[model samples]
Target: MDETVQKSCWGVTAKAVIGLAGVILLAWLVIGSESAAMIAQR
Candidate 1:
């Protein structure tokens, strides 16, 4: 039972990471100029 719970938690975390990455990509595409300026500032 503990192992199954741990696996479920891990799966949720993985999905969250993937979703975040997708959102970041979409934002980068939409805000192309701002993203480029930020990168240049760094």
Candidate 2:
């Protein structure tokens, strides 16, 4: 029982980490594009 619970917890943590990473990557891309546009305008 304890081992199963530990595994479940790890699974949830891994999913959360992956989701957060995806969000960060998306935000970085958007911000990077805006920055590049601004630089190009100048």
Question: Using TM-score as the measure, which candidate wins?
Answer: 2
The TM-score measured for candidate 2 stands at 0.93
lDDT by residue (tens digit), candidate 2, 1-42: 999999999999999999999999999999999999999999
lDDT (0-100) at residue 23 of candidate 1? Answer: 100
- Residue 11 lDDT, candidate 1, scale 0-100: 100
Looking at candidate 2, what is the lDDT of residue 4?
100
- Regions of model 2 farther than 4 Å from truth: none
RMSD to true structure for each model, in Å: 5.4, 0.5
What lDDT score goes with residue 10 in model 1? 100
lDDT string, candidate 1, 1-42, tens digits:
999999999999999999999999998887998888899999
